[model samples]
Target: MRLRSRLRGEFPRGWCHSAQWWITGIRDLTLNTTAAVATVVFVGEAKRALRHRDEPRTLARLSGTFEGYVASLLVNSGGLAVLVTMAIEEGLPVVLTALLAGWYLPNIAISATVFVVVARSRTRQPAAWAELDFVDQHAPKYGRPPETIEEYRAQQLRE
Candidate 1:
């Protein structure tokens, strides 16, 4: 199938001849890449935070850091913000634009405060198997658990 057809019929016939189509395609591609990067960072941060769940302050700081990362990514990358702005420019429905803005504005506020919230946080350390078991509650379907933090770190790094 053609790329134009795969885009949910948003680009009508002969759209390639129009500047709007090029602009929209570029915007979509950029935002999609940004969102994918944000998702990876979010997942990594979540896993790191889970390992440190026993430490309340550390967990909070890690969680806050990830949240800030997401908010900053969104505001800086202009994914949903671009959508709302485009909707307004195209004279789309007020309710639709308002809904998009509702999601966007809070991230603007959040991105502004991320640095203040998580300034001096530390990085992740390997937790014990007992702690991991308590958190995961699932047995490994492979070989034995790591004997030391170094070994566990090596295993995780391999993964």
Candidate 2:
């Protein structure tokens, strides 16, 4: 019957047709917004670390990794919830495949972006550290390495 087909997600179920709207909307509200906020904050902190020339890049990288994991977990779980809801409404065999794919694919792509940023930052940074060390050694008037940035600043002031 048409009812069975629609219930099983075999055909298009527009807005208000099935629980699809509710499920997707819920995830958008709960998981997506939170992920976006966390991503922004993490990125800002990473930029701050770079600006300050701090060695806490490792912490920033790990935090980025955690953010990616949280995003993946929430997106996949929300997608699965929607899929299960659809399957329950209709039938498992006919659950809309596009909905299933749509749910997690974007999150996977976003996670990959997070991964690439972390990796590239690590690669670019190691070389930059040598430059930092070089400056630390040569730019100090006495040709001595300062133990900390604060010490370096004090030496520069005296010079």
Candidate 3:
């Protein structure tokens, strides 16, 4: 009699469990994808800064965008907290929860450290607003900003 009743249920024999797994999986996937994109942008900006480290005013322009990166990292941390909470509340496997924490926790820490370095650099280099004004006047079209501030200044000099 028990077996017969189980078979007749709306979500027979673990189907409901499968549905919960899928929902959590989708949420995890979305969060990870967003984190990956933000990481790429942050890394790209770092590389650009390195490539022009010797040039005047480059740090200023780069610092202009680091705040955005820090903001996104904080938002990612909040999302991670919600994910961890969901995993615990929904009885998710321990390994999966551990993996998520292990992956993102250090990421948040390291990324914040990098932002701190960038912030310090901004303080040491204080010509950011002047470069910004240069950008405003020279790249007013917004479609064809120079690849680097050095390059833009050189182009402006030539013109």
**All-Cα superposition RMSD per candidate:** 16.5, 22.0, 19.8
| Model 3 C-alpha lDDT per residue in residues 1-159, reported as the tens digit of each score | 256432333233455556654675566565445444355444555566666654445644553245455755776688688878889789878888888777666657645655666666556665764555454444412123354465467457535
Which of the numbered candidates is closest to the native, going by highest lDDT?
A: 3
User: lDDT tens digits, residues 34-131, model 1?
Assistant: 43334343444445554654554455434333444555656555867587678868887888777766655554544434433333232333343234
Clashing pairs in 3: none
Write down the TM-score for model 2: 0.31
lDDT head-to-head 1 vs 3, winner: 3
Give the worst 10-residue stretch by lDDT in candidate 2.
5-14
Error of 1 at 77 (Å): 4.9
Give the whole-model CA lDDT for all candidates, comma-separated. 0.48, 0.50, 0.55
Q: Please, what is the TM-score per model?
A: 0.34, 0.31, 0.46
Candidate 2 regions with alpha-carbon error over 4 angstroms = 1-33, 36-66, 69-91, 127-159
Question: Which candidate number would show the highest TM-score if scored against the true structure?
Answer: 3
For candidate 3, the lDDT comes to 0.55
Clashing pairs in 1: none
Each prediction's total of clashing residue pairs, residues at least 3 apart in sequence or on different chains, is 0, 3, 0
Which of the two candidates, 1 or 2, achieves a greater TM-score against the reference? 1
